[model samples]
Target: MEYLPNIIFAVALIVGIGFFARNVKKLSRNIKLGKDVDVSDNKSQRWKNMAKIALGQTKMVVRPIAGIMHVIVYVGFIIINIEVLEIILDGLLGTHRLFSPLGPVYNFLIGSFEILALLVIVAVVVFWIRRNIIRIQRFIKPEMKGWPKTDGNMILYIEFVLMLLFLTMNATDFQLQRIGAEHYVQAGSFPVSQFIVPLFDGLSESSLIFVERTAWWLHILGILAFLNYLYYSKHLHILLAFPNTYYGKIKPQGQFNNLESVTKEVKLMMDPDADPYAAPVEDDAAEPEKFGASDVMDLNWVQLLNAYTCTECGRCTSECPANQTGKKLSPRKIMMDTRDRLEEVGKIMDANKGEFVPDGKQLLGDYISHEELWACTTCNACVEACPVSIDPLSIIVEMRRYLVMEQSAAPTELNNMMSNIENNGAPWPYNQMDRLNWVNE
Candidate 1:
């Protein structure tokens, strides 16, 4: 019976981690649902990109204040969780302060954790103010209206509560240690939580123990809850940014991926002496009949990865000229819609036992629109602004390719240009006979 608490803790840990793993599996399947493209080149450069962008957070510092605040929350929160390892060990063994034997090292580690936890609290508050009081323009954009807004604030609240619980747990434990209460070891140097210890001064030993136990339980359980919550939150970037950045598009930012099949046909047409029915080149067999992305499956895996990696910070949309000029396209929204549709597809696949039923919906016309896709200047501004190296423009271009190729749905201006190029070898209607008209005039 004495080991019952340990058993319960173990069960809770398993369930929490198990649920997170299941969601991760589902997420992986959804990402792989996107069409394959080789991102295997430039191994060393890819590693450098992952290190600089994801780990070093190189792009985040563009706005120094928010950057510093995010660094505090990000680094502080992550470093503070070093204590979580100890907490887990103690819980599983039914021990109090299991690492107390490490003596001064343990004290320093706990002290650092407490300091980082306090900084995380301050950072989270500033983030809250940015979202609510100051009302950052990006946070208040149209896409941020409903669940996105609520989820943003909800995560902040959760972090605040978790950090508070940690300090409170330490404070109550400190008081118990001062009173020499049983099993409350004299461990951990709580530099920040020490100020909070005096609150429990007048409490009876039993009451102090009760408060300490409650805080401890809540802190650990809350961590577990937050772990699971990541799957449904934008916070998943904390995990995915690594692989996403590694597999990120390394091609020149403004370069569009050409349709090799179309290029081959054009080449053959240009060569009047070439055989029409000759064996297709290497790329022909693997080339998709449909030229561009109409659905999540039509987009390359990297674009889908970009959708999943989006922080939804609106850095992309904020930099977008089309959005500034009041066009309906928001690059952030494009990524979000892609993610949403991918999720919907994933759920359907799972429901139908790993196969998707025809849902009468596609990424191009359904989740994203002609207006949004057309509005993109292919400017690569969103790609440049993204902190995590997500390329919303890539997805935009792929969907646009579908409009021009498969559906013949391009706007009149583009169609006319293409026609001119085809007929007169230029982007003008003048034939070779009239080519010197402008010169004559």
Candidate 2:
């Protein structure tokens, strides 16, 4: 019995550390591949954001059921570590009963943990049903139809099983202690386990011992394996989410990256360069690069990383009015396209062992389409919906800015709108002085 605790602890520690190290390396590689981003600019804002999003879970609460359930499970997981520690101590140290101090307080802790465990199990089961059986529209994709559906479901199931195992193990232990043994009544609470005591009344001493040993091993091993499995799956978010949330963008969603000014020698040849207010170009001899994304390679590292980080939660696509109205634009598709293009180009680049460029065609014209770019209202619904803080609207706006400023190619309506804004201070074709014409004077 004493050897069992040592074995579980040794195996769990080694496996946990090995898995953690391997995942850390993979995460480091992913971070290195990301584009240079400035997330440390506003110290106060970052702290405030962390407090709200991480501690308070402000954004998650928008979906009450899911949010509340997740919050409960998250808190439960953190607090239950103490219980796990106690279990380990009892198994290895021959303590049999743990947390026997502060009679009422200990009982309360046990009771609360038991209730939370039950709740977590229930919540996880509902989550699985929601993702698989209920098949929520927001969770599915047409392209995902043929893919294996077990990854998400499996994680949820593992969590459910772990919680159930914990409860069962604790209940059996509590029953044994109540039968004249020094029960580790750490608190005054134990409602569920107390009720469970009746079931063990008819069992013989040998049967009770077998049940205790089995439940302990199952609960501990199940939890340890689940922890290790987290690194290799989407459940990586369990560790990655905190850092990702802390490093999120602090700027307004609509702002685009500012382009740098050209050199003096090149600036003289262009007429706009001679004017102080005019936009700068690279050089007099340098040909103008086409505006907007030409291909997947043109995306910055952060944009490329965004593709990998997407959980396929479909919040972006669901919030997109274009997708809702039956248009070709799905923000989710845009993300997937970026990922696919990167993989395609990466393959060619690796095969040739050199930088590879696609044959002449532009990404917008060939892959994304001019209509799709024009369809965006810049409403920023996708920006708000993203759980990982990927800013699709910023990408769209940057591309739109490139089209208008560099290519001078925009939709007919946009062209007219720009002309009106340039000459009359508004997109409407009305006199600037008469802007308040509708007001009763």
Candidate 3:
């Protein structure tokens, strides 16, 4: 019975990690549902891009105020978690500050963690103010109304609570150690928590121990719960941003990828020497199942990765020309819709024992409207603004391709232009003989 606490901690760790791993497997499966496109061409350049954008936060700094605040939270949250390793060991072995043998080094590290914890709290508070009181335009967009707004605030609250618990745990431990309480070691420098230690000045030794123990347990368990929460929140970008930036689109922004089958048909049409009545010689390679993305399955894996990696910070939408012009297409919403559809598809696969059963819904018309797709100007502003290099434009173009090729439902003006191209070899209705008539006259 003495070992029961350790056993419980072990089970909780295993269960949290196991459930997260299962979700990761499901995430990978969903991403791979799309067609494969090779993004392995550039190694060094991809590395450089990832380092600059993901690690350096290059794009995020374009707006200094929010960027600085975000950097504080991101850096503080990451660095403070270093102490969690020691916490894990102490929990499992039932030791008090197990790294105390490292003595001064451990003290310095704990001191640094505490300082960062304070900074994280400050940053989180600023973020809350920005979202609520200051009311940033991007945060208050139509698409951010319901769950998205709640999720943004929820993460900040989680960070605030976790930081408070850490300081409380440290403060109580400091008081307990001063009284030479049993198993309360003289360890961990408390730069910020020292001020709070005075709050427990009048408490009895047993009550102090209760406070410390409760804070310690809650801090660790809260971290574990937060780890699991990433799957549901936009905070998953904290992990995916590196990979997303590394595999970001390498080609020119305006250069659209042509379908290979369509290219071959075009080549055949242009070849005058080719036999018109010859028997067709088939290639061994299998043809693509779909031309363009009507659903998530038709998109490439990189596009799916882009969808999942979205920070939902609205930077893309804020910079989008269509959105600026009051159009219905928010690039942020496109990524959100794609991710929502992918998640729905994943849930259906789970319910059916790992095989997907269609539910009469598609990403194009169901989650994202045709009007939204048509509103895009293909201006690449959203792509340029994404801090993590999530290419919402690529998904937009693929859906547009599906609308044009599969559905033949292009806007009337677009249809007219395409018809002009087919008949007169340009986007004008004049005959070829009349091409130079205006010049001569």
Clash numbers, per candidate: 0, 8, 0
Against the reference, the lDDT scores of all candidates come to 0.89, 0.68, 0.90
Give the best candidate by lDDT: 3
Cα deviation of 243, candidate 1, in Å:
0.9
Q: Is candidate 1 or candidate 2 better by lDDT?
A: 1
Cα lDDT, model 2, residue 165: 69
Per-residue CA lDDT of model 2 for 98-141, tens digit only, reads: 67665677777888888888888888988888888899876676
How much is 55 displaced in model 1, in angstroms? 0.9
Candidate 3 on 208-234: residue-level lDDT in tens?
Answer: 989998998999999989888888988
Candidate 3 — which pairs collide? none
Q: What are the runs in model 1 whose C-alpha is more than 4 Å off?
A: 271-288, 432-441
Question: How big is the positional error of residue 54 in model 2, measured in Å on the Cα after superposition?
Answer: 2.1
| lDDT ranking, best first | 3, 1, 2
* Candidate 2 ranges beyond 4 A from true positions: 1-5, 88-98, 143-148, 180-188, 198-201, 260-310, 332-375, 395-441
Descending-TM-score candidate ranking = 3, 1, 2
Alpha-carbon RMSD, each predicted model: 2.4, 6.1, 2.0
**Tens digit of per-residue lDDT, candidate 1, span 80-126:** 77889889999999999999989999999999988888999999999
